[model samples]
Target: MSAEPPVSLRELRARAEEVVTPEAWEYLETGAGAEVSLGEAESAWQRWRFRPYVLRDVAQISTSCRLLGHDLATPVLVAPTAYHEPYHPTAELGTAEGVRDAGSLLCLSTRSSRTVERVAEYAGPWWLQVYVMTDRDITEAMVDRAVAAGASALVLTGDTPYVSRRARGTALPLQDEVALVNVQQHLAGRTWSSLEQDPRVTYADIEWLASRSGLPVLVKGVLRADEARACVAAGAAGVVVSNHGARQLDRVVPTALALPEVARAVADQVPVLVDGGIRSGHDVATALALGADAVLVGRPTMHALATGGAPGVTAMLRALTAQLAEAMGLLGISSLGGFDRSLVEDVTHARG
Candidate 1:
């Protein structure tokens, strides 16, 4: 524990409401559609229970794990979310520093308020998440920028071809007020944006994107075994099990519900990571135990940012790591690898 008393992720959340505009907080917290999907993801997390072991020396526990071929001090990776400047002036730069300080990787979004290079300048083991534009030229340019920015991996988020309407979350009237600054170059100083594409992007585009990228590419938003296999065959170096934070598509299965099949499909060919509804360090353990190589966390981190900016983010991440270590100790586990599918017994039917 730090010399300072530990604060719950909840305390940070309340701080976020006070610090950020009501509208921005709402936007950061809400999910799209009827929100049944978001509810499912959270509920899915509850069905998992860690079967603890007895009489083992696990006093000094570690949650360090490797992701995209790099070691993360914890299984946590900061999920890429755009427009972080809405809460703080430093934007992704501050988030990157917090991620580094927490010994984790930061995955940045293409829609980031900070340029990918600007972000990479302060980054620690970061990856870039891309949204393949419908226009091939724009897509190519985005890939080039990520490479130029020193991103170690290219993650094409295949989900969300359109904007999600997160009803419960608050947002600034200026939420639409924030322009896509980096992509603004594509507009060529023109008043019109013919280059912009619809949100209905697809896997075929992901395959095309992989062919175009110079760096190792990973496909985000894989929810099925077949999609996972297809991504590998299409030359993706890795895949993320996600549901766009349940911000897209209603009534879909939680990421965890589908993790095993995708993990088996990807097998050892490449690493498989998962995101959506991760709340605690134990959730990270549960993800690894369910076959996810690492976990991506977004909203809760945003909640921290809304609450305390850089300092709160650092605290939130550190607390989760400590919780993860505690969970590992209770399970008589030491190393991150000690978590495997054997650690989780699916209690869904029992939950019913």
Candidate 2:
């Protein structure tokens, strides 16, 4: 029999933990070093107090928006997380279908177990998240394949030169468990160690990737205003203010805290997005108020997929969108454009 659907994100994670193996659970939950950044990232959103307007017409609310020329039913997008196969039998296909059904979008990871072509068959509007490897050919080939397979854009992960030392170690044997179907043939008898992310990657590489693939590239893992500005100068089509989900570094600034500065740096030259610790529609509104064009949810998507596969993911996306619409109505804002810095204020100190 299928498992019961989750009623809350916390419950959803609890159910997923019950089914996922101990090692996989640790791999999924733990962060680098002391995990300080990981723990703080989630709570950072709560510091923002919404300044809602009253007496405004809220009879019609629309959460619809466009990103990089693609229309979305909601401002929420599925952030790229690797190896969905371990979470469900359907894996990325399940995620693709769920996001498509919800009229949202998916960002497929480079380390995905599913091939780009296969996912494209099941996905709606999608983008490819890339990790430039030691073997640049492998990265380029995959990007070319994804472009051919219908990827609308490329999201280049700027953090993570190498995987950080997580607080908890796991014995999941990722070499065997991960199919890496997208670039397996390109392995060319090379050692797995040889394929580690190239630490030498720089701003110039960002321009190269976009020019080579003929697709707009959004640099992810940015936290500073200067870095965001550099990315735009280097021809990045967008900027994602993320701390690599707080997995790459310990004690780093949270995306919520970093977003406004990064957004201001770009000056709307490109779309700015924020992820990490986004839990509800209120947080979505908070992010937009802080200058994000949209928000991305990572772990919750995995939790939902693990519990009930495609339906679970679809339900989760729909629930969040519904909450966002409700939040818009309650805030007396009728559209996505209504969100601004004026809508939120930092209440970290005056909470009393």
Candidate 3:
């Protein structure tokens, strides 16, 4: 382990760039066409002002929360990102061990470089992020393997019906050998892109997956309230308001801006989580105040993994959780339930 913890997220990214190839950096950082959504994601989080409550007992603030029957030390989760080997030699194994050590959860991607069983050996509480393939049988088989390997829930990524054109219009050439470990056996010597997302997948597939695997299913990449409600009606255990980290489309609403509408749509019925440009603990608190059950962090984790490996990830998660506790105390809230929509206001609409 290094003598010191990793630096701030910006520094981590800079350091990662020094060690990681330019192609890998571009694949990790850039998003779809025009990059408008990507550019606005972090700034969108900054536009919310906290309506803090004062003069209450906050000395005993707690950051603990429950999701999908598992207790978490913090609301921050590792959003499913593919091919960790590009960032770290340990691959998903290091990320899993880091998340486990930090008392957070990992949502392992269906495209992870590591196998479900191998990741389970190091991961603590984790969910399997699924991409329903052109071959339904392949998708189902993947789900079954995740179930057998001890994934707590299935996060059905609903937005990626097909790959979008990146603004750069190129990606690092990730060999199938390093990117398809989880699905390789099912591919029968075919290329990884052959396992394309099923464009025809409907809301009904959520119920079908839950029933088939006996695991709770969360629909990720939903932005519209109507779509969130539709997922719930079709038996979704939760809804993640995301634009696939702004990787799916250009100029889509950032998750911070889209969260409240989706939260109002189905938060009472199921957990509503959001991801996209969540950079700090204050951002996490703002997410909760906006009615999210939790928030997921993606690029930051990859940066940490690239720079400091597992220990860096653990340090970053701990620092965020600590910052959350501090924010809760400063906001005069003692627990996760204390946050509500009344606690935040979009600064764009504020008047003097």
How does model 2 score by TM-score?
0.95
Ordering by TM-score: 3, 2, 1
What tens-digit string does per-residue lDDT give for candidate 2 at 1-352? 1122324677788999998878777877888789899999879999889879999998888989999999999899999998888788898999999999989999999888789999999999999999999989888999999999999999999988888888885645455536667777788777886578999999998898999899999999999999999999999999998988788789999988999899888947999998998888788889988899988999999988988899989888888888888888888899999987888889975545
Minimal lDDT window, size 10, model 3: 1-10
Candidate 1 clashes: the total is 12
lDDT of 3 by residue, 1-352 (tens): 1123323667777888898888888899998999999999999999999889999998687888998888998899999998899898998999999999988999999989889999999999999999998888889899999999999899999898989989875566778677667877888856656698989989989988999999999999999999999999899999999999888789999999899999998999999999999888899999999999999999999998998899888988887788788888888899999998878888999767
lDDT of each: 0.77, 0.87, 0.89
Model 3, position 78, has a per-residue lDDT of 94
**What TM-score, over all chains together, does every model reach?**
0.90, 0.95, 0.96
What residue runs in model 3 are displaced by over 4 Å at the alpha carbon? 1-7, 189-194
User: How many residue pairs clash (N, CA or C atoms closer than 3 angstroms) in each of the candidate models, in the order given?
Assistant: 12, 0, 0
Looking at model 2, the pairs that clash are: none
- What are the runs in model 2 whose C-alpha is more than 4 Å off? 1-7, 171-177, 349-352
